[model samples]
Every structure is written in C-alpha cells, then in structure tokens.
Target chain A: MNDPAPKTVPLDDKDFRDQLVAIIPPLRAFARGLCGTRDMADDMVQDAMTRAWAARQSYAAGSNFRAWMFMILRNHYYTTLRKNARMVSWDPEVAERVLVAGPTQQDGLNVQDVQKALQKLPAEQREVLLLIGANGVSYEEAADIMGCAIGTIKSRLARGRVALTALIDGPAYKDEPSDKGSRSPAISPAG
Target chain B: MHPQDSITMPEETVPERGLKSVKETVIASDDPIGKALRRLHDEVVAEPIPEEFLRLLGEIERKLNGAVTPE
Candidate 1:
C-alpha cells in the first residue's frame, strides 16, 4: 500500500471519536463567531469536521486536539474564502440585527450592545478576542491555530477589548466626543 | 455510551507565555465587558448542534467504515 495507516486510528478508538464529538460545541461557536451567522457557521463546522475525519492520521496523539481541530476549521474557512475570492471584514452593525434585546439589562450592560460592539471589531481582532477570551484557548494555542505570533494574538486581543469597550460603554464616543479638553486616561486609542 | 464516556477531557496546561499581556490596560475577565463577552460565549456554546450535523458525522463514519461507496 502506498499510503500507510495513521498512528491514531480515529474510528477504531472510541476515545478519539468521543473527543472529536466533544469538540463540536466549541468548533461551532468559533465558526459562528467567525462567520457572523448560524447557518454559515454550521456549514463551516460541517466542512471542517469532514476534513478533520479524513485527515485524522495527521493529528498528533496527546497534543491539543481541540487546537488541531480549530486549526483545521480556520484553514477550511480561509481556503473557502480564497476560492470564492472574498475576504471577511469587520462590520460593526451586523450583530445588531440578530440580538434579542430584553426589557431588563444586566448590571446596566446590555447583551445586544455587547453583540453589536463585538461585530464592530475586525475579523482578526474578534477572532483573537473570542479564541482567548471566549473559547478558552490559550495564546500559544490560539497563535498556532491562527498562524500568528503569540505577541500578535495578544496585541489583537488588547485592541479588540479596547474597541469593544469603547463601542459598548461609550456609544457616542466615536461620533461625538463628550469633552476633548478633558481626556479620560482609562480609555485611549494610543494602545 | 457510558455516562463517564461523555466527560470532557482535562484542559491542556497553559503555557507560561500564554498569560503575557500586550498592554497594561488589558481587560480582566471580571471586568463588565469581559463578563458580558463571557456570557455571550456561554450562550453560544450552549446552542444545540443541529440534526444535520449529527447526520453528517454518521455519514463520515460510514465512509470511514467503507459501508457506503464513494460517490
């Protein structure tokens, strides 16, 4: 046989199969965060999962399996984007249409506002923010998945947080400066 | 499937460099914005996986097993 078998037998090992199944939740969440829609995200997840299954031999045993799956998902996304001759950009207003605003706000922070603010961030920044902040991946793993330096991931995350905060907390800051004379040191664009 | 089979794998130990912050003002997880994002993340994670995806997994499994001819 020209092609040898993979060290980790994906179908034979129940543990591996179970592991793949368990990662679906985070995989779907990451895809949705990247795609900005449930249907598109699920499509991406399905594609990624299929590819992951076919290429299971490449996966290193005892490594970060979820990270590997995430890398696959990201690669699938970028490949599809390239094939379609399109690139994803950040649109601040996209999430505003989907969020269900409740009559009561939690701790004076609205979920819809947060979603809208999140949508405002660039795709790179949002991915870093969600990967580290939301999806619970470490910077190193996120860097490996995103194919960037750890420092870059950190920088994007920091910028994403600042932008999101400005969008959510100070909605009018971008349009109308409350006081240009008095600058609040807490939130600044220099970082 | 055994009840214990569904137990999640332990999280990988974080690399020390993973904790490095790019800026002094990096938002803490306890911050209002951080909390909100985490809540959103939880909500997304809690969303049910569609039946179509489950079916896809079955198809992949069957293909791996050679039970279905490759189209």
Candidate 2:
C-alpha cells in the first residue's frame, strides 16, 4: 500500500496547494488582525485555507495566490461577522502576540507593539489597510474582495491612515520602534 | 465531490500579476514603523499555533477523501 503519497494530479493542482499552504503565515496575520483575537483568526484562516485547498482546481494556476485567497477569506470574514458579529480587536499589540512564530529581540524594538497598533483601526478600515498596506493587493482587488467599491476602500484606508498616524506619532502602544533601535528611523505608512 | 467542481473562482482566468506594485510597495517602503507594523501584521496573520493547525488540516484533507479513521 502507498504510504499516504499524494495521488497523481495535474501539475497545476499540486503546485497550487503547495503555494496555498505557504501563505498560511501571512493569512494568519491578516485573519488575526481582522478578527482581533488569535482564536477567531485561527478559525477564519483555517476556514479559508480549507476552502482554498478544496477549491484549488477552480483557481487558475497562474493567478496570484495571495489575492485569490484573500477573496475567499474576506468573504468569510464579512459574512460570518454579519451573521453573528464576532468582535475582534483592531488593536495591533494583541495582533503581534497572537501571530508570533519565533523570537523577536535583536534590538529593543518589540514586534508586539506593531501588532497592537494595527488593531487600533476600525474593522472595515483595518481590512483594507492590511490587504493593501501589507499584502499589496490593489485597492480594486481589495474592494472586490470586500465586495465594495474602490472609492469606499480608499475612504476607509484614509481614515485608517489618520488613526495609525496619531497612534505611532504618540505612545499609543508600548515599545515604539525608537525604543528598540536608536539608529533606526521611525516608519510612516504613506497609504 | 468532483475535483474540478470543488475549485472556486468567479471565472476561469485570474488576471496575471495585475497588481504587483501593491505588494512590493506595501511590503517595501524602508519606512521603519510601517515595516515594523507590517512585520507584526505578517506574524499574527498566521498565529503559528505550533502543530495543531497543520494536524487539523491533514485530518480535513483525509476526511474529504472519505478515508476511514482509526478508532
């Protein structure tokens, strides 16, 4: 008997699942940021990934796996929230702690602080911000994923930008980047 | 379930790299805190809850195939 070997499939299907699983780290971060808790994000991403794997053949193999997966996840996040409105923290500190894969302490700068800061934005705003701000999905793609107009994504992102500026410019979260490296300049998101 | 039917997309063709700038700039921008924020963002987005998540995924994949599990 074969020892759990993957059944022979189209090269595309096999490649797609491999890529899909690789994005788990980033997907986890997005889910946690959106849901505001580790528990919920875990569920969200698991749901999304499962859907993605099962639906891999539906995926055009050459397409951007990141955006395709985001569409699935954003769909799940909004629909589930609407049905039973699970409140997730927008505060980014909780995010950092929630998504840790390894130790972070080269300098005094704490990764956790960045997470709490991300969590501060409103849910809708945070969704765009993470999608565009981090993963690099276009505003249009993000809008499509969120089932909203591009203009709406732009508006929410603007509001999110203002909120983040106010926080990072001040001590909204502990362990600001300056606290870690005296030489490292502070970062400003231009979005 | 039919393998082809299980796949999900609005259409068969997904635009090829229509938005490369977003990920590059978003992930780039030598901006320190934005970088920091992004680093944190990437980390929590996954939650790397050790091996539990992977195990669950394997189980789901097996179940979908109608494979029997040992009691």
Candidate 3:
C-alpha cells in the first residue's frame, strides 16, 4: 500500500480549521471538474467539508489530510450520483454547455476549449486526470481517494490524456481535409 | 510517497507513438492545455470565499470550541 502512516498529533482546532480553509479552492475545482458546473460543484464541496468537519476525530494527523478530504468529497459525489442516477449527464456536448455557463469567459478561448475537452472524458478517467494533472495530487493519494490501485490510477491518466488530446486537436484535423477539398468529413474527420 | 506520485505526465514514460510528437507539444510549458489547467486552479484560488461557506466553517469552529449547541 502507498498509504502514509498516520502520525500522532494532538488535535489543534485552529490549525485544523486553517488547513480545511486552505484546501477549499482546489477542492471546489476538483468538484467542478467532476460535476461539470460551479453551483453543483460548490454544493458537493459544502457537503463534503461539512462531513469532514463532523468526522474530524476519524481523520489521522500528519498523513495526507487533503486526500482524506478528497475521499469525503468523492464519496458524497458518488452517493449523490447514485441517488439521482437518471440525471447523469452522458452527453459531453451538453455537459460542456452547462459547465462553461455562468463562469466569466475572461480566461480566453484556450481555457474554454480545455474545459470542454475535460468534460468530454469519462467521469472515472476525468477524476484521475484532474487529481493528478490539474490539482498536482499524487497518484497514490488519488488511488487512495479513488479506492483503487496505483496502477489503475496510472491507466486512467494515460487514457484520459489520449482522449483529451484527441478531443482538443480533432477539430484541426477535421478542418484540414475539408480545406484541402479532396476528402469528405465522414471519411477523414478524426484523422 | 509512492513512485507514481513522481509520474505527473505519463507521456514522459510511455513509449513513442503516432501522437507522441503532438502530445509533447500539447503538454509543453506554453501549451494552451497546460495553461488552461493552470488557469482553472488560479481562478478557483482567486475566487472569494463564499459567505455561506464561511458561515459553515464558523459553525464547525464553534462546535470544535466545545460551545454549547444552540437548539
């Protein structure tokens, strides 16, 4: 197991609260990537933080508190997922529309495109990618948060990267054949 | 602590493939994908902490302080 051994530390409420507050942004960002919208993602973060605070006694000190909190957030997300199975947004296109709305477009088209590409990934793969690529979380920590082996986390990262690349660059390739006027869209869109 | 933690971008280790060149370009320091991901993190960090969230945190703080629970 890649899990860190829990270190002993007398619980300091002020320090604990500071740590919790510090992680809110990344926590919310990860949630946004998972749920595909700011409001829904913040709701997930709120729920997870509440649960984490309530269960403070169970949290081990000096071990990876971020990962522990992430697990809580992920668990809440999945529980909510199970409760409303029908509303799971399967269509990436639709997801892109929903997630990008309300957020200011001041970040430029590149950010916008990447966000869209991210939502295009499968939830499992997307979560791993965000945990590693975006949030700088370790694979071991991610695997622990995700309740999977490190190898599984690696595979998801690989697959997610490939899919993201394809989605991001696919349009340029599609335009090439059409611009050449020598090939049709259906035959060479993904090439 | 795990070896995989050292592995940030899998493309660095994965054998060269048809998309290897393109993938390298995409993951480059100045690449949009990388920038976008960074921007996402930055934007989140820049956002003001919501009052509702702060209130929630205050509630937790109060509870942690052993304050009597208000019915």
Candidate 4:
C-alpha cells in the first residue's frame, strides 16, 4: 500500500480545497437534516464552510477529513441552536413542502412522511439518526463528530431507530409539546 | 410435527421477542426505514450545489494566493 498522507498540510494546498469542495454535498445534506429547511440548511452550510476555511490551519491533514468537517459543522449547528433555539428547531410543514417539490414525485410522499417523522424525534435522537443512518457515518466517526463515546453513539442510534420506526409506522401518534428543559430537547413544530 | 412438539420448544417472553425484532429491523440493510433514510440523504447529495459556495471558496483562494509573504 502507498504511504499515508502526512498529518499536516499547508493551508494553501490545492488538495485541501478539493477535499473541502468534495465534502460540501454531504455536508449540505447533514445540515439539511439538522435545520429541516433547504434555505436555512444552505445558509448554515455556507457559514460552516467559511468557519472551516478560516480554521483550516488547525486541521490534521491525514485525519478523517469527513468526520473532522462534520464535527465542525455539528459544533457550529449546536452553537447556533444554543444561541437562538427557535431558529434551529425542525419544522415539519416546511420540510413537507420542500420534499413535495423534489424531483422524484412518486417517492415524494414517503420521503415527506419520513422527514416529518424525523422532525418529531428528539433533537438528540434525530441527529443521531441523520448522522448514522442517513449520512452513513460509522458509529466511531459519529461518536467523534458528536463528541460522545461510542457506547453513547450506539445507544442513541438504537433509540433513534426504534423511535423513528414507530413514528413513521404509527400515523396516530401526535406531537408532544415542546419540553425545552428536558434532556432530549423535544421541540414540537408549530401548527 | 407432532402436537407435543410445541411443549418442547424454548419459551420466549413477549418483550424479549419484540426487542429482538426491533433490533433486527434496525440492523437490517433492506429495512424500509433504512432505505428511506438513505434515499433522503442521497437525494440531497445528488443536488447541484449552489454556485455561491464555489464563488466564496474562490474568493478565499484568491485572497490567500495574493497575500504577500515577508522576505
């Protein structure tokens, strides 16, 4: 096998820019899952990209670039959420409208249902699902990105999957009121 | 199978069976939920990224390349 790339790269390296550019699509998806609206998601992604470029000097070159970038995006997302809690909470109606407008019309209903169900999950569980299930990050990478232990990641993933399946399968399940003080930060979407 | 074979089978609790099924569903690659999640992510990833992102990165690259270094 070829020797691994060094752990350090100059800030001006073209490879770094290429890697960053390559990561934007998935990064945007992650942001979309978190923010629940395309416009807000794109805005957050741009903000994250700016922050990532500004802090590129600190990145270890050979490390998991995707995970590292995801960590930065995740951190920025939570920081923004903490600063203005209302701004980041998932909005199911908006999500449905967006998904309904997607290119694939036949699959749009199911996708819309899943997105709505995803929004109903606790923020912690929803993020875990998005990162692991949707984003296809390994449990270890997800742990690194979320700054949690692997066990915590697994636990969240299991709970998230079970909860998400229930939400999607059970149409009668109503949205619970937002309990900001709870550990889950279950934000109920406004009607 | 004889009718008495039912009595010889190992007993499984309802909750345990339910949990196992949930775990299987979660772990299964072809599970509907997993498929849906991947579809959602893939749809977004397939989207054409906005031009503004590229423009912003270009601006950054230009600024970096143009900056003078001390002799």
Candidate number of the best lDDT: 4
Candidate 4 segments whose C-alpha is farther than 4 A from its true place: A1-12, A88-93, A100-109, A171-191, B1-27, B68-71
Residues A1-191 of candidate 4: C-alpha lDDT, one tens digit per residue: 99996445534556778888999999988888777888877888888777777777776656677777777776777777767878645665676555534634353237767776777776666787888778777666666666656556666666666667678787655543322222322211112
Models 1 onward score TM values of: 0.69, 0.63, 0.69, 0.74
For residues A106-161, write the lDDT of model 1, one tens digit per residue: 66467666765665566666777777776766677776777666555666666667
- By DockQ, the better pick of 1 and 3 is 3
Candidate 2 structure quality by residue, lDDT tens digits, A42-124: 78888887777666655654445677777778777766776774364354454444644654645433555545656665566
Q: Which parts of model 1 have CA positions greater than 4 angstroms off?
A: A1-13, A83-105, A171-191, B1-27, B64-71
In model 2, where do residues sit more than 4 Å from their true spots? A1-12, A89-114, A168-191, B1-23, B27-33, B45-49, B60-71
Report how far residue A8 has shifted in candidate 3, in Å: 6.8
The DockQ score of candidate 2 comes to 0.18
Clashing pairs in 3: none
Better of 1 and 2 by TM-score: 1
* Residue range with the least summed lDDT across 10 consecutive positions in model 4 chain A: A182-191
Candidate with best TM-score? 4
Question: Model 3, A3-95: lDDT tens per residue?
Answer: 896444534667778889988988988887777767788898998887777666566555577777777787777777767764346455555
Give the DockQ of candidate 4: 0.11
lDDT of 1: 0.61
Residue-pair clashes, model 3: 0
